[model samples]
Target: MSFLKRPNDFLFRTLVIVASVSLATLSLLVIYSVVMRYVFSDAPDFVEPIALLLVIVIAMFGAALKVREGGHIGLDSLVNKLPPRGQLVATAFQHGCLIVFAIALFFGCLQMVEATMEDRIPIIGLPESLRYCVPVIASVCIAMFSLENLLALFAQKQK
Candidate 1:
């Protein structure tokens, strides 16, 4: 009866671990840099890129988990008062909106990546590819979340 034995539980825990590690490592690095900067009067040039990369990585992994856990911003107060069938309908509609948002974001991200190929960050001069990969990952996460939600909704109806 371990929760992680369930497939969804396993996936959810894996995602949570990954996101937590990414953010924690970033936090530690930032703290170390700050300590060095104050104590030794110097810091490495790579901190900014590393920090930004950590932010993107954490956000990409965390987004799907947030959606799966129903942690995303929502108008749930109104829907909460509805009857069971009405709630299901509302959920279906809400998931439909999520699907559309994901699709639009996916396309928009593609356009951005295409337009920014020649551009580069000023400080790190990292390739635009590195920066724009975030949107691509985010779009995929959002799509996955929407699919999972719909599946859950369907299964709920059967029960």
Candidate 2:
């Protein structure tokens, strides 16, 4: 468990850092874009596409981080009322659902990435698949965290 904890902690911390940096970059980009548009009347053409990518990074990474922290919405009040075994089952079910959803998201995003590989983002000229790649990475993280939680739940049950 300690060994698993170390890697999981590292992953969680990395996600948090990535999300924080993305958010800061997105904020600064928005401010710069606004100032350029309003004051200089010469907004950069690349700003919109770059900002869109940054937003995807912030949102997907943030959601993955929330899963690791157990900060996402859950029916805790309802689960708490159940017996210990029932609570365990409910928790396992929740984690299972997250794992399943993350897997589906990953596959779906992969298909999107493949389908859009030849298309370029309008202003940035980068492959349009770049946008979907963010979700693919985030979904892997989400699946890992959910699996970790699910295993921990079963381990606790055994104890």
Candidate 3:
């Protein structure tokens, strides 16, 4: 219980909260948009565009959320077949690959955000900045998860 007070715990919680809230809010708005479109005469002009953008954010951040939560599915059948010591090595290798992937997400997102400045969404004519939010949010979450994973690796070594 006391371990929950540690800095790593704080960071993990923050990432989960951010990703979940954003996705939930977006989901709600999408439902509302559907209702309004069907029950009312015309769809809100911006509804589709806004919803589309938000949906991207939801999906991207939600991926990181899954990873951080350990809800991301693992191909453990093969690893489980290995001997105990082999399993440890495999797990460490997996985490290392994940860290690299996270780093790629963070940097790749930054590049996207910059390169999309001149791009625009077809319907909304909104600058691609709105679309880039997906990657930005994902990058942040992945970075956070990677940091947490690093700490966990070290903790395991210590134990």
Per-residue accuracy of model 3 over 47-122 as CA lDDT, tens digit each = 6777777667667767777767766656689989999778767766776677677677767767887888889887
**How do the candidates rank by TM-score, highest first?**
2, 1, 3
For residues 1-159, write the lDDT of model 2, one tens digit per residue. 566667888889988888898889989999999999999999888888899899899899988988888777789999999999899899889989999999999999999999999999997799999999999999999988888888888888788
Off by over 4 Å in 1: 1-14
RMSD of 2: 1.4
Tens-place lDDT digits, model 1, residues 45-140: 888887988888788768767877777767799889999888888888888887788888788878888888888876788776676677676666
lDDT of 3 at 16: 66
Ranked candidates (lDDT, high to low) = 2, 1, 3
Error of 2 at 33 (Å): 0.9
| TM-score versus the correct structure, for each prediction | 0.82, 0.93, 0.76
